[model samples]
Target chain A: MDLAPLALSLQVAVLATLVAAIAGVGLATLLATARFPGRDLVDVLATAPMVLPPTVLGYYLLVALGRHAALGRAFEAVFGTPIVFTRVGAVVAASVGALPLVVKSSRAALEGVDATLVQAARTLGAAPARAFVTVQLPLAARGIVASLMLAFARSLGDFGITLMVAGDIPGETQTASLALYDAIQEHREAAALEMALTLTAVAIAILYGVGKLTARSARGA
Target chain B: MAPDGDRPSLHVRARVVASHAFALDVAFDAPPGVTVLFGPSGSGKSTTLAAIAGLTRPAAGRIALGDEAWFDADARIDVAVHRRGVAYVFQSLALFPHMTAAENVAYGVSRALTPEARGERVRALLGRLRVAHLSTRRPATLSGGEAQRVALARALATEPRVVLLDEPLNALDRSLRRELAGELREALGQLGVPVVFVTHQSEEARALGERLVVLEAGRVTHVGTVRDVDDAP
Candidate 1:
């Protein structure tokens, strides 16, 4: 109900969405462009989370980053602190849970780039890297933008993963979703309703902006 | 440099295989003049142009210029498309929708040309192609003929050893195609390079090519002058 928890949640979501979107675009570009032996398998792996239950993803994070886990131990040794039960852990959980959205959308976008355009670039004497940067990447920008926005929305409202991995630490890790839950648990209906309304408005506005931008890009082309 | 003078500027012998759909297995040559490849739909004319442009790799074969080899079987030397000095004007024109006509043409020129020289070359080429007024325009705004010229200028700007044109006028209407074919033939002659042109129209092939290479079912059916094709059909 307090603005602090909501604010912290927004920060975590923004960071998680950014990292996830970058990782997703990179992975998707590889999947859509490269001809590696197991590239199809890589696509399947990226898309796995899209179909997987968010709670199951949260469960995996719990196993990987819990204090007794190997990853947790490594983080502890490197930073003298564990990630789980902290804000850092919340971002990791959110990113993992939302990763598939970015990958699948970006791949679809990249695939939409015409092979004829690529061949044309090649014939015009553009190297592979130059062609990708000048031709393929620019054309696929709309898809990447859409994916990033979707990932952001997904991160903004994440509940199960953050609760499982970060344990809803107040002021530090307790985000808007967690605050809403706590208010409901305490029967503070007014506070919960206010938070929910604000969250909904912000998400809608951000998504609408991204959608308009993508449409403009398509039209401009 | 068709060094032997009797030999062609470009020669290719290769087999390219696509997954379950197409395989372009053929050998051909284009001397220092207009050489057209003619075929029906799905007859692999475009595939052959792509192979010559080095956009598609042949299964096992050789590609050679007049004196130097672009590709060799025993040495396994396969030059990248850009480095091969072969320009391709695709069927769609494939003009960069974002870039202006001048910029698109300048893309193929290397650092050897000064910025002024590059600009001059682009302007001169656009003028020569009779699309100079559209120099600052993007592909998205241009007419079909304008876009085609932009693509042709882009291909010629590179000063390639050989030029590959895949159904260059296929997208145009009958009237435009007829008008442009004569202009295109003149431009090809001016470029002073071997042209590997592809067309579905037998008349177009005969009109543009000094030599006509007919492709049927992914194989080279005839390799001779236009008169030879007239005799066959």
Candidate 2:
């Protein structure tokens, strides 16, 4: 009857999805629109997480958010909160794991928008910010939803990053995936199977919802 | 000499480099009337319109509207599109799909007005263009004529020093084209500003333009009234 792991999993997933979506949309904006020196380099770096194994990302996050790391120590000194082995740390790991999906989908959505629509806004006396908010963003709203769904689903299944960085402290940092893994190792076959089935069902439902939105029904709406 | 009066005039000299492997060297004067630029497809008529509207930068030249320079490469000053004292209605109409007809019209005047004034101005524009009742309709719902008029009203809403229309009548069928062409002519004529409009059809050029510039290839072949064009090939 230990529900702490399940609660921690949900909390980490929600927080990670939020952080990844924000960063991904911002990154997508740059990828789809901005022209700068070394733009390709930034694109590669942002997408690096996608190609990396979750374990690799976890290892990096472990070092980056750990006590001795510059960022971790700076946080402890300035904000009185250390990320490692904490719920927030689990969130940070999950966001890193799911970032690629958000970035890729958001960029595609932005690129699919009509540039002429942007020009039309300009002639209508809209500044760049106004044009983006009123025209570009709405036209690409479908793509945005796709990004969110991908990030949310991926974050929900994040295990390696959480395991490596947050260290499976049941009530404090152990997410659903880590708990399932732990249950399997401890020979709790029924519990592990149930958790696995629940995660799979959630993932499938989210994917089905995204498919429905992309169908003609959402366009007419 | 021409009549001495206060009327808007735009003198534009521009050399356009083709996106492909050619250059469209064009220059013309639009002196406070509907000066039609007529040419076959790819003859650089649109290039000239784009240059005047500040959409395309000329390789080396100058553009001035009523004694004010819009682009002077020699002086290294090229005004950006929104601040060029000109309004351009592109061939595609390029309406914002998400906005209603009234909102599209209101968008231009919105930046310069209080909310109440913006609403009134949009309504007046829609009424003048005879699309007042269709204000709530999205662009996808509007007919070709309605959309064109909405674009025209939006362009003219700001009272630009010059109005540039490129193939404004090409999108419609013959009957609608002729009907809206009249409305288009009235809109341009009523404006006390320079209008350099472009078209490919000889008939449309003759009907709507007070002055015509016929382009052959990438050069100006003739500049005169309809009779001059009729007497040519």
Candidate 3:
């Protein structure tokens, strides 16, 4: 069978993981540290995608990034291409699907850091930014890494949202999961079986890496 | 002006209203010597140190180091923790776990001193604290007393105007505590900065405190020289 679907899936998931790692870790730090009115509400909203149905998330994304929508128009103005049915669309869908995993796990990691340690750094003449980079971030790094691995695995398996936004365009938008579905519909059982095994192996390897990272963090703590 | 020419004093007047259990309503002045905040646990001794170090904001107070105003609630001037130029040796000995003893001490030294000065200061302070052998070791590898000395070296590396010791020796065994207490006293004497030493142990207070300020339930019960407190009821 063609390997283009597998390549496309890898590209989408890698880009999505990068996006989630930066934005998700930042959001997690904010949730773990800052306190203000309705902070709990914002936290719930950030993690809602995890429990919400993938189709519902896809529908919302479609509405928000539709060709005529405000945000979609702005993106088109800059890129001269609509987000819908594009490779970028798949990346966005996978990133959203993976975000909750990163945020929830990384938030726990950040909170596990001792408040007294942070205070000690401050009183030792370290500014807030310096303390975070030198102490808090390093202390929480293992947990963040484990969570990112889980997010990458989750993004690779994303089907519903990716299908909704990127659609089936072979060698472009059709990711491995979408290709597997197409192979099954066309009665190509061998191709479907190969894709399924490949996906399963990739998922298992990622999950095994995540397990090792978490074990290391627990021992360090 | 101080009697010793331009030698500036540290003045702290704070009224921090927390719950009855943790509230702090106290004030005292410290010259260039060890002034112990002697009290039992939960008597707001640590709170007072935190307020002076800018880790805790007081409800109404003024904290000044010489002529520099660190915090003044009425005047609405509160310096950030780093800018206050106050160093602390936390009771927990909050050493950076990722860095070696030398790196931890070097952190503060590198911030304020030139590169050459930082190297010299780190070497001298670590040698003084007797942690020169453990310079490359992480905090987890060090013993409790070793960790405490590393914390002290890190604090002193900044050459702070004030040093706050929040029960730094509490975690050690009795003999180790006594030995380190003597070393700490010597170190403080050489540094020439006003030290706010917090301790619940009466022996430590007597051993290190030139002046004693007693606290009970968030209020200053007595403030005097060590002899004055010992002579009182």
TM-score for each prediction?
A: 0.93, 0.92, 0.94
Winner on DockQ between 1 and 3 is 3
| Candidate 2 lDDT tens digits, A58-103 | 8888788789999999988997889888877888988987788888
Candidate whose lDDT is highest? 3
DockQ of each: 0.73, 0.53, 0.81
> Sorted on lDDT, highest at the top, how do the candidates line up?
3, 1, 2
Candidate 3 error regions (>4 Å):
A36-38, B1-5, B110-112, B227-233
Candidate 2 chain A has its poorest 10 consecutive residues by lDDT at A212-221
Across B1-233, the per-residue lDDT of candidate 2 in tens digits comes to 11216785788777788777768877777888788888788888778877886778888888987667889989998887777767778888888887899888877784657889889888999999999999999998989999999999988887778888889778899999888888888888888678888888777877788888888777887889855656543
How would you class the docking of model 1?
Answer: medium
Q: List the residue pairs that clash in candidate 2.
A: none
Candidate 1 scores a chain A TM-score of 0.93
**Candidate 3 local lDDT, residue A118:** 88
DockQ of 1: 0.73
